[model samples]
Target: MKKVINNPENVVNEMVEGFIAAFGNDYKKVHHTNGVVIKNKPNRVAVVTGGGSGHEPLFIGMVGEGLADGAAIGNVFAAPTPNTVLEVTKELDSGQGVLYVYGNYSGDVLNFDMAAELAELEDITTKTVLVNDDVASATKEHAFDRRGIAGDIFAIKIAGAAANDNLTLEEVARITQKAANHTRSIGVALSPSSIPSTGKYTFEIADDEIELGMGIHGEPGVKRTKLQTADELTANMLDYIFDDIELQENDEVCVLVNGLGSTTLMELFIVNRKVVEILNEKGISIYDTDVNSYCTTLEMAGVSITLMKLDDELKNYYDKPAYSPYYFKKGRG
Candidate 1:
């Protein structure tokens, strides 16, 4: 329960305020809501994303120049309200349509779909692409039933870039959908993240054990076993990803080695090192590799590896300049 704050109930609000204070020049709040939008939106199709708040640099950090146009923020590990999502849509919707991108969580799906319906009443044409990239969540036959994790960044980046190119909403949505379909991710948790409001860890694991393929909120993983070395663990996680995606030799990919909060860069790089070695051995070319804490559960000690199988079409958009307080993978010069 050791955290710096005024009140537990006010953590989301306070965090939002602090984020604004630090990044107000590029973003602004939707009227009376947790929805955050770029201060000056473009005339192209808008890409909006959202989810629970604890995963900082996620729903919020994804907004910027070549990223999401707006982000509807929910409470910690909670989905954004329909009203909050609608507000963000209202702000981002130009003459062009809007595309909604978010993780494939039940609460998030419910709220975002409601928001889309509400937006439709306002004559804002909208499309949705759910990021269901967590390979360990479901079998390959049930890929669409899986959860979204670090793979969300791939969808956001491709979609945001296509939108910035002033492509039609349909085209942008298509590109985003392609990215979501091509992405696969898997994670292992060494420790659980603490809930800010309750000051309790969301889940528990023995100190000598790790949960393979655990979801960010500590949803049950595929297995729990004694902790292994970084190389072994990385390969174990990748086994699931490779099984999910039929990666072939000479295929190109964008790899994301994401850290869930407390994991250090040093450890993350070690994991990434193993990832590179594996991909190289498989003869799969890497378009780019980003090893960072782009998505996280608060101070959760674990890392998730995401692979976005790329086609030339997807790569064109992915390489576009994007920027926010976080995520400089394809940032502007």
Candidate 2:
């Protein structure tokens, strides 16, 4: 319940206002909406992604050159209303078309679809690619039903690159779907996060325990057990992710060690250390790696590992440079 804010109900609005003020040079708040579109008008295919707030550097922090062209900001841990999505879609649509990429959550799917339908009334063509990368959410038999998490970063980057390269809307959508399907992730939580409004923990765990395979929004993990060492935890998570994807020796991949919220950089690097070691042992080449709190739940003590299996096409797009508030990368190595 300890949060630095004037009022719980005003957190989303206040935070967004501050964001626009700070990043005004790069983005502008859409009129009458809690969304921001990149200041640089998109001449190519426009890209948009959004979801609930609280996960900083996500839906919002990602709008800029080479990333999301527009983002609909929503309430803490809640989906953006269909109206919000519609407004963002309108702002992002260039003469070419618009592509919507977001997690495969029910609320997002429902609202984004509605927004797309509304955009058609204006003759603005729109398409969507849902990111469902949390391997722990479902078995391979039901992979499409899996929830999205940190792997969103990869999906966004890949799609943005394709769009930046001037790929057609249909081509961008196809490649974006390919990136979404090739990505996989798993997370472990050491402590639950507290919602600012209620000042209540989403869930609880013991002092010496951890929850494996948990979702960013505190969804139940596969199991809760005494905490294991960094190596053990990394192995458990990687094993599950690898089993879900066919990553062979000599294959190349991108690694993302994403902190849920409060986990330290020190801890994330420790996890990354083990991730790289294991990948090397398995003969997978690391193209490049990122470790940071890109997507997060407020004050949640956990981290998620995301691996995007790469082909030449995926690698080319992934290497394309991008600039946003939180995520910035100069093209590939």
TM-score of 1: 0.98
lDDT of 2 by residue, 33-52 (tens): 78888886658899999999
The residue pairs that clash in candidate 1, if any, are none
Q: Candidate 2 — what's its lDDT?
A: 0.90
State which candidate has the highest lDDT.
1
* C-alpha RMSD in Å of predicted model 1 compared with the true structure: 1.3
Q: In candidate 1, what residue range of length 10 has the lowest lDDT sum? A: 324-333
Each prediction's RMSD to truth: 1.3, 1.0
Give the alpha carbon lDDT tens digit for every residue of 1-333 in model 1. 478878889999988898899999888988899999998897889999999998988989999988999999899999999999998998888879999999999999999999989999999999999999998898888887999999999999999999999999999998999999999999889998888788899898998999999999999999999999999999998998888789999999999999999899999999999999999999999989898898899989999999999998998888888888797764432
Each prediction's TM-score versus the true structure: 0.98, 0.98
